[model samples]
Target: MQSSGTSSQLDNPPSYPCEKLLVKPWGWKWRSSYWFVTFVVWLGVATDLLVYSMVIPVVPFQLEELGYKHPASLTGWLLFAYSGGLAIATIPVAVWSEKYDARKLPLVAGVVILIGSQIMFMEAPAYWLMCLARTLQGVGSTMVWVVGLALLCDETPPEFVGRQLGIAISGVSLGTLVGPPVGGGLYTRFGFRGPFIFGIIIAFLDLAFRFLIIEGKSASKLRSNTTEKPNNEIALEANTNSLTDIGNDVDVQNKKVSFVHILRLLFRSQRALATAFLTFVYGIIYSTQEPVISNHLNSVWGLNSSKIGLVLLAGATTIFASPLSSWLADLQGTSVVIIIALVLSVPWYVVMIIDGHLALFITAYGCAYFFASGVLSPLTVELASVARSVDGIGYAHVYGAFNLAYGIGTTVGPVVGGQMYDHIYKGWLAICLLAVGLLGLCVIVAFFYVGEEPIVQSFTRRIRLL
Candidate 1:
């Protein structure tokens, strides 16, 4: 019989990627596992949005408490500052991520930034300082959103990417809907410092999870022998380094392009541009509801804090649509799903304009929320598809563009909507009209450009069958 020492030496061990280490990382299995990675990304996204919005209801009151006039306007500008930082940081972050192929580091660094911003927001006394803190928060938020989603895409399968992304995006629905209530609840009980303190705690948890994730590529590298690599390992490596290309009209392997050039070509593709516009419009719909609509509900309907929270909570109930949207995207094509959602949502936006019907208004908001949440998955999946079609473009790059579109929407939504609401009579009408117009444009764009073939051609073919 072999001795125990000989038996122990016979077992093959995975070598770490580092020159120094001789074995797989401790906790590598869970740290690099698919579900675990997805959960981390989901939490990463939820944490960012949770904290970003945790102080939403409280911001106006905080400003008023600090003796600032026109608290609504100041709140809008603060959101503008956040969006400004998001817009400004996206490109540089994208470039660096692509160049380095590192996600977790930036993600950790981002959470740290978010923590600092929360502390600043909690302690700052002046309006400009608040703006500065919000801007920093935006920067931190961009890091998580762009890189966290990219990391998810990296770990997921090609066919299931849409569905998986939809699941992750459910975190957005959770964070957005839950944050204000949680914040409002804390405010009711504990006053000014309550929300920020909670935010810091959640962000710390996020930082730890982000630190724990071992990327798929790195984990794959731990296999010292090619024969020892499993199918999953092979698939993961293929996602990054496969010779076979999908898109036509370019030699993907031989033709090298700069990030800017790849981005230009991506935008030139009607499919990508349409999806980007859809994301932008979705951001507008979401941002319009927060400070603007919440304020409207309070001012017009005389809603107390609890009533306002209930309305937003009602809106979030349809988050179930996210999974259905993802499945529809994978099955029928994302373009079709987006088109259907946008069409169904139009009436709801129109319905929100009616002032006399609280129950009806609540119904409209919930319907609108369902469709809005549905739209995000298809847009996310579509953008990833676009990036795959082009050579030298990565998830990081496209997601940066994604963040850029969202930034513009969030920035313009509040600033312009707030201005119209504050300075103009019938400003609610203007905001409604604006949302309706953007939705109409998105519908047309998706019909023409969001699919493998224009949806009108499919319609024409179907008509012939009839």
Candidate 2:
């Protein structure tokens, strides 16, 4: 005797024994809370970065211990290997995750792979094996990053995405803040195997957290109905929907869900292209000077691994600004935030040209790192926005491409920077100049082509009016 509206609204509950006792998953409400999902992404990113940078200071020494000549060059090669793996995996992972509607599966699998990499790095007898391990690390990390960000995009609302992403990205900042000191200290005290053993344990913890989390789509399987009607009632309700439901269905149908089509729609946007470039630069900022920094410090100041880690720590203090930068980008638009951060970073890179003041250099370096870090959240948000603008485009397609750009940057940065440092005259100075020039290029492009409405379009509008 129920109305069609009521019948149509009912969800199908399990018709087994104690069907009335069926309920939503235990603690389902909080496990999928806004912050929890963000934390999972944050933790995933943080763990990967932490594990990567944690071993950086130890790499040259480890190579030296393995009797490899020119450990610095080898260190650069290892970084290149890592990046190459990331680049190689980005497309496949993105395509698969989107095609299969999966996020957590890859995330959990990635951590297990990450743990295997750490163990291999800790025990690998040959240099090539170590390289293979690093490459594997990159492959594993990309899965977490590509899919995790896409998941974040799914859970977060459009208006708040930028800020939430900033918060999640702060985990990268935290990882950088903590990783080096811990790695260096552990290595200095306990040798090469110490830090990675810690890493393995941490990876397991990350795996557990990811396993516990339930994505929104997966949660749809849970039972939430209070009224379970007969089979005839279900039949009657199957064809009926309210006007709002019909409208939503039309909207879903209107969106172009084809992966290739969605990708093409994003590719056509200038802002998305510019954001991808910024992410590439982000990879460069973290990787290029990194291989050289520990060597430069050891040669110039005779600092040990522990002390060098402390120095890197001092320079990374600027990472704290990411949240503020994301908030600003949310408020003022991405172009302004991107421009200001890069411009301020220019003077700091110039400080690298200075000769022999460790404290001063660290201050400048940290300041530069801070400014560079600010751009990521904004770019991430902007890139996601661009994809969202394309009807039916998922976040994975854009972030997959995002990971590819970053992987390329990571590969390009260490190899080029390390080679230049090894052979070029005033190479550090040259690198500084190059960084400044690239920053300028980024600023120019961002001003003209980035954000909600680029400066170029406004200028074009004015000329047309004239």
Clashing residue pairs in candidate 2 are: 315-366
lDDT for each residue of candidate 2 in 1-466, tens digit (9 for 90 to 100)? 5776566656653333334333566787667766788989999988998898987898888888778777777889999999999999998899888777788899999999999999998999898998999999999999877999998888887778998888888888888887888999999999899999988888898998898788875454343334565744534444343454588667756653666776677678877788888889878867888788888888878998999889888746655777899999988888888889989999999997787788888888888888888888888888788777865567888898889999999999998878888888877787788889889989989888897888677779899999
Please give the lDDT score at residue 60 for candidate 1: 74
lDDT of 1 by residue, 1-466 (tens): 5777656544533333433323567788789877887788778788887887777777777777778787667788888889888988888888788667779888888999999999998888777898899899999988877888888888888887888888888788778778878877787778878888999999999988888999887777555432445444544545545443344224533454577787788778887787778788887867765657667888888875556666677657656777789889999998889999988988888988898778888888888878867888888888899878876778988898899899888887778777878887887877887888888988988888887777987889999999
Q: Alpha-carbon error at 234 in model 1, in Å?
A: 20
Q: What TM-score does candidate 2 reach? A: 0.89
